[model samples]
Target: MKRIPLLSTAFIFLWFSTTAQDTLTLSRGQCEAIFLRENLSLIAGQLNIPMAEAEVKQASLWPNPQFTLDEINLWATRHQTGGKEVSPPIIGNWGRNQQYAVSLEQLIYTAGKRKKLMALQGVGVEKAQQYFNDLLRNLKLELRRQITELQYLQLSEQTFQTQLQSVNDLLSAYERQLEKGNIAAMQVTRLQSKQFELQKELHELKQQNNETQKELKQLLHLPPQTFLKLSSEQFERALTDETIPTYQALVSKASTNRPDYQLALLEKSYFEKSYFYERALRTPDITVNGRYDRNGSTMLNFVGFGASIDLPLFNKNQGNIRKAELGIQQAKMLSQQVLHNVETEVAASYKSLLNAHAFQKGIDPKYLQRLDHSLDAHTRNFLSKNINMLEYLDFLESYQQNKLSILDAARDLNNAVEEVNYASGTELIP
Candidate 1:
C-alpha cells in the first residue's frame, strides 16, 4: 500500500476532526479512517450492540418482587354501641386495628428459564454485532466507489471548463469580427450554439457531482453544503496484484468473513435456543408469598408464607414453541440462500473485474497526455487561419471524448476492485 501524504494526514485529523468547512480535501485512506471513526451510520450501528447487550442484561435479571398492601380502609367506621362515644382510629393503633394487611410475592424461575433467556439474548447481541460489521463493510465499499467517481468527475469537469473558457474567448473575438463585417453572423451563431451545448452538458455533470458529494457528506457527517475535493492521487495508484484469487478461495473466505453469513447462522442458533425457552415456559413459574395481617388471625401478628403455580391445563406455550421451531428452519434456509447468493456475486464480480483490468491495460496514458498537449497548438493554429476550423473542431472534440473515456476506464477499474472486495467479503484489492 502507498503511504498517505503528510498533508492529507494533517487535514484528516485537523479539518475533519469536526464538521468540515466550505471545502475539504482528503486522500482515500484519510477519508476511510475518518469514516470508521466518525460516520453517523457506523456510530448508530455500534450503539446498537450495547443496546442488545442491555437486552441480555434485562433477560438475566430476576423479576422484581411484587409488594401488596391490601385491606387498607380509607376511613374508619365508628361502631356506636348503646350510644357510647366512638371515634375513628388514629395512626397510633395501626397494629391493633383490622385496617391494613401487607404481603410480598416473588416469581421464582423454574427449569432454568432465566439462564435460557439470557442465552437467547446473548445470541441477539451477537447478531447485533454482526449486523454492525456488515454495515461497516457495505459503507466502506460505497466510500471507495464514491471516491473514484468524484475523482473522475473532477478531472472531466476541469477539462470541459477549460475548453469552455477557450470557446468563450473565441466567440468574443468572432463577434468583434462580425461587427467589422469580417466574419458572418451565421458563423458566430453556430459558435454560440456549440458553446450552449457544452454548457448544458457541463451543468448536468455538475448536478451529478453534487449528488455524489452529498451522499458522501452524509456518511462523513459533514455540513450538507460543504465542498468535497476528492483527491485523485489514490485513484491514480496502479493496481499491484500479480494475480486474482481463485473462486473457491474467495467463496471460502466469504463464508468465514461475511457478517451476513455469520448473522444468519446466529439467527438459526437463536431460534434453537428460543425453542428451548418456549418449552421451558410450559413449566409455569412459581410465586412464593409472605404476608402479615394486623388482627385477622387468632394468633397475634399473624405471619404466613405461601406458594402458587399456574397449572399447565390449557396454555403450555404450544404456539410459541411451534413458531420457534419454524423460525429455526427459516433461518437455516436463509443462511443457505445467502451462501448461494455470495457465490454467484463473487463469480460475477470476478468476471467484471477481469474485463476492467484488460481494458485499463490496453490504454497508454502518457501517449494520451502528449496528444492532449497538441490540442492547444491545434486550436491556436485554427484561430490564426493556419488550419481549417472543421479540422480543429474535430480534433478538439475527439480529445475531449478520449480524455473522458480514459477517466471512465480508471473509474471502471477502481469500481470493479471495490465490487469484488465487497462480494468476496475480503480486501482483495489491497
Candidate 2:
C-alpha cells in the first residue's frame, strides 16, 4: 500500500491559524520585556526605589531654623506695659511706639548623629533596590515556568487532536460497516468510547491551557481578550554538556548576585547604624538662639545670644539604644540564615538541572521523527483493514505515551534550567 502523508500536522497548523482572537506570538525575551514594562506588580515594586531615594534626600537635609516673635504690642498702654518706655527709639516710628521681640533658634546635631542617620537611610535605599531586584527574580522565574507549561500543554494538545481525528474517522467508517452488518456492534461501541475518552482528555488539556494562558497574559499585561502563543523557536532547545560549576563557586556567585542575600547584609548594616544613631541620641542636641528686643530688655533694641540643651537627667534614649543592639543581633542571625539557605538552594537546583539535562540528552530527535512516521503507517494499515481495531488502538495509546513523555521531559528540562537561574539569582542557564 502506498504511504499516506501526515494530515494531522496540517490540521494542527490550521487549528491555530483559525483561532478566534488575534494571536500574539511572543518569544521569551518579548514576554519578559512586556512583563517589566507593564506588569502592575513590577510597576509598583519600581516605585519603592524612588521612595527610598526620597528618604535619602530627606535625611541629607538639615533641620529648619525656627523663628519666633513674642511680646508684641499692637496698641501701647501704660498699665499693660507695667511702666512707660524709658528709652528713645530710632529708625523712625518702627521702634518708637511698637514693642516686639524676635528670636531664631537652630538645632545643632552632636556626635555626628545627623550624618550617621543619613548613612542609615542610605542603606535603606540600597535595601529597597535589592528588594526590587529580588521581586523581579521571583516573578521572572514564575513567568518562565508558566511559559514552559503552556508550551508543553500546546504540544500535548497537538498529540491528542491528531489521535482524536484518527479515532473519529475510524468511528465513522465502523458505523457505516455496522449499518451494512459487516462489523460487530461491539466494535462500533468501542470506537465511540475511545472517541469520548479522547474528547475528555482534550477538554482537560484545553482547561489547563486556559489557566496557563490567563496567567501568562497577566504577566505580559496583555488584554484579557487577546490570545497569546509562544514562537516555535527554541521550544526544544538543547543544552551543551558544559562543565557545571563547583558547589563552592556557585555559592560564591549566589552570594554576590542574589539580591535577597545582599538585602540581608544591608539589613545588618542598617541595624548596626541604627545602634550608633541611638547611642548618639544619648547626647542631646543644642538649640542656639539669637534674639533682638524692643523695650523688653534692660536696654532698648538689645541683641543677645543663648544656647539650650536637654540635661539628660532622665530618658536618655537607653531603651532605644538597647533595642537597636538587639536588632543588630537579630539581623546578624537572619543574614547568616539567608546565606545558608542560598547555598543549599543553589546546590539543590544545580543538581536538579544536571539530572534534567542528562535525561533530555537521551531523547534522540531522529528517533522521535521515526516514531511519527510509524504512527502514520500504522494508522494507514488500520484503515485498510490490514491491522485489527485492538492492535491499532494499542499502538495509538503507546504512541501517545511516548510523545507525551518526550514533551514532559522537555518541559522538565526547561523548568529545571529556570530553577537554576532562579536559585543562583542570575541567568546561569541561558
Candidate 3:
C-alpha cells in the first residue's frame, strides 16, 4: 500500500514530462516552408551555382605576363667589364658596376581560344544551375512524400487509440463481472486476450509513428525535443477531383519543367562547346617578349622585341579533339534515353494515381459513419448480455479491420498523388 503512492507519483511525473514537450502543430504547407528554409542539403546545393559562376569569371581572365631577370653580376670582375658604362646609374656607382638582363613576355592566344574556352565555361554555369534545380526537385518530392506518410501514420494511430480505449473499457467491465461471478473465467480471459492484442497493435503503430516523426524532424530541421503534430485541416480534401493531364501534355511539361531533362540538354551543349574549344587548341599561342640588357647583348643598353610560338610539327591536340567529338555523340544518346524514361514515368504514375483515386472513391463516407454507430451499439448490447461473446468479439474485429482498410486506402491515394507530382516534376495533382 505504501508503494502505491510512489508509483502514482512516478506515473504523474512521466505524464507531465511527456506532455510538457513543446508541441508544434503545423500544416503540410508550413512544414514545406520550414524545410525549404532550413534543410541543410538545399543550403549546400545553393553554393554550387556561385562556385560555377566563379569558374566562368576565372576562364574570362587573361594570363599574367612573365618577367625574367638574368645574368646579374652584383660585383664587377675585371673580365666582365668589357663594355663602357653606358647603362643608367642606380645609386651612382652601383649601376655602373652591375650587369643584368630583363625581359617581359605576354602569351597571346591564337584561333580565338580564349573566347572559346570562356564559352565552354559559360555552359558549365548553366549546367550548375540546372543541377541545383534538379536537387530541389528531388528533395521536394521526398519532403512531400514523408509528409503524406506521417499524415497516414497519425491517422492510423488515432484509430488504434480509439479502439484500444474501447477494449480497455470493456476489459474493466468484464473484470467487475468476474468478481461478481456474473461471467465465467474463460470469458474474462478472452476479453483479456483481446485487450492484449489491442495493446500490441497500438504499440506497433506508435513505434512506426515515432520513426516517421524522427525523419520529419530531421527533414524540417526541428529541435530533437520538439514534438510535432500535423494539423488535420483538409487532410482528405477532394484529391480525386483534380484532373490529370494527357500523356502528351505531361510529356511536354516534363520537357519544359523537369530539371534532370534540362540538365541532360545542357550536358549536350557543354560537349558541343567543348568540341569547338578543343579544335581551337590546335593553334599554338604566341609568346611576345620585350628585353633590355646591360653589357649582355651586341651593344650596351640593348633593347629588343621578339615573339615565339610552338611549331605544329608533332602534336596538334588530335587526341582531345577526338575525345570531345565522342562526348558529343554520347551526350546526345543519353539525352534521348532520359526523355524516354520521363515519358514512361509519367505514364506509370498517371495510371497508378487513377487506380488509387478509384479505390478511395469506392469507400463511401456514410458507410464509415454507419460502421462507427454500429460499433457503439454492439458494445452496449454485449455489456447488457443481449449479444453473446462470439458476436461481440466478431463485431469488434470487423470494426478494427474496416477502419484499417479505410486508412490504408487514404494512405495509398495520398502516396499515389505524390508519385504523380514526383514523376511530372510539377505539382500537377495539387
Candidate 4:
C-alpha cells in the first residue's frame, strides 16, 4: 500500500526505465507541479484577490471635502477696483473690493454607513478568493484527465506501431513469394489489403491522440511540435480498495473543503451584510458648509455656516432594502441547494471509483503480454508454413483488441481517481 512518493529521484528512475532519449518522460507529480505554476487561467485568477481588496479599501475611505471659489470677477470696473490694482498678484493678499466669495462643505455619514460598507467589501473579498479556488479545482481536474489520457493513448500507439511493422514485413514476404511464383497474386493482394487497413486504423488513432496532445500542450505550457511523453507505468497494477472513507465522512470533508460550497455560504453572509448596509442608507447623509462674502452683502465682510439633509419622507432607500432582503433569502436557498448537490456528487463519484476498481481487479496483469508473445509466435509459424495465414490474422486481431481493452481499463481507473478528487474537493489519491 506504499506509493512512490512521486517527487523524489526514485520516481525519476521509474519514469525513465522505458523512456526514449529525446522524449520528455513525466510522472504524476511532475505534471501537477507544472499545472500549478504555469496554467494561464490560474495566473489570471490570482489578480482578482487584489482587486477585491482595493474595493474594501475604497469602501473604508471617507469622501474628500469640497472647496469652491465663488463668483470671482476677472476684470473689475474703476469703482470696484482696489487701490493700484495692475493684474492680481498670484501669491499676494486678496483685494477687499474685488467682489469675490469662497465656500467649503464636508459630507458626513449618519448611521455607521462607512463601517457597514467596509464589512460588505470584506465579504466581497472572501467571495472573490473562493471563486479563485474553485477555478483551480476545475482546471486541475482537466489537467489530471489530460495527462492520464495521453499516457493511455501513448501505450495504445506503441502497440499499433508494433503490429503495423509486423504486417509490413508479412506483406513484403508475400510480395517476394508472388514474384518467385511460390504464391499466387491473390495472396499478395490479401496481405496488401491487410497492410492498408492496419495503416488506416493507426492513422485514425493518431488523429485522436493529436487532439489530446494539443490540450496537453496547453496545459503544460509547451510550445508547438513538442511531443509529450507520459509515464503511467506506476499505475499499471490494480488499485488498492482499503482506506476509503465512509459516505458521511466524505460528505463532511466536502462541506469543509469544497470552494464552491464555501462560496455559497459566503454569498449568504454577503447578502446579510448588504441588507444591513442598505438599511443604514435610510438615515440620510449630512453636508455642512461655510460661506464668505466681500462687498456683496450688507455687512462688508461676512462669514456664516449652513447645513443640509435630504428628507427621509419620500425615499428612505425603501427599494434597496427590499432588494437586499430578497437577496438574503435567495442566497439561503441556493446554499441549501449546493449542499444537496455536494452530497449527490460525492456518492456518485465514489460509486464510479468502485466500478472502475472492480474492472481493474478482474483483469490479469499478464494477460496482454502473454497474448502478445503468443501472437508473435503464431506470426512466425505462419511465415514458416507451420500455420495458415488465416489463423495468424485472427490471433493478430484478437491481440490488438484485447491489449487495447486492458489499456482502457487502466485509464478508467486513473480517471476515476481524478473524479473522486474533484468531488471530495481534495486530492484523495495523493
lDDT of 3 by residue, 1-430 (tens): 0112212454345335545567777789878877777778877788888888898899888899999999997776666556655455677556776679999999999899888988999988888888888898888878877777778778877877777787788889989989999888999898888888888887887888788889888887777877778866545647645476676777788888888888899889988999999999889999999999887866878899999999989899999999999999999999999999998999998898888888888889888889889988988998888999899889889888898898778778777877777777777767
Q: Looking at model 2, which ten-residue stretch has the lowest summed lDDT?
A: 1-10
The digit string of per-residue lDDT tens for model 4 on 58-132 reads 998999999988877765677655455644443466552466788999999989999999999999889888999
Worst lDDT 10-window in candidate 1: 80-89
**TM-score leaderboard ranking:** 3, 2, 4, 1
- After superposing candidate 4 on the true structure, give the runs of residues whose Cα lies further than 4 Å from its correct spot: 1-25, 73-94, 234-238, 296-299
How well does each candidate superpose onto the true structure, as a TM-score?
0.83, 0.91, 0.91, 0.86
For each candidate in turn, give its C-alpha RMSD to the true structure in angstroms: 5.4, 8.0, 8.1, 5.6
lDDT of 1 by residue, 1-430 (tens): 1233333466557676645457777778877876776677777678888899999999989989999998765543445223432332445754223456799999999999999999999999899989988998999988888888888888888878877887798899989999999987887887788789789879988998998998788777776777888777868548644767777888888898888899889999999999999999999999999999754467546799999999999999999999999999999999999989888998999898888888888888686778667877886886898986677678768878888888888889888888888987888667
Better of 1 and 2 by TM-score: 2
Q: Which regions of candidate 3 are displaced past 4 Å?
A: 1-19, 82-91
User: What's the true lDDT of residue 357 in model 1?
Assistant: 84
The local distance difference test score of each candidate is 0.82, 0.84, 0.82, 0.82
Report the C-alpha lDDT of model 2 over 1-430, residue by residue, as the tens digit.
1222322464336436656566767777767766776678877887888898899889878899999999987766677656865545557655555778999999999989889988999998898889989999999999988888888888899999988988888889889989999989998898899999999999999999999999998887777876777765566756877745566777888999999899889988998999999989999999999999888877777899999999999899999999988988999899999999999999999898789888888988787898789888988898789999899889988998999989888888888878878888888668
Q: Which candidate number maximizes lDDT?
A: 2
Clashes of each: 0, 0, 0, 0
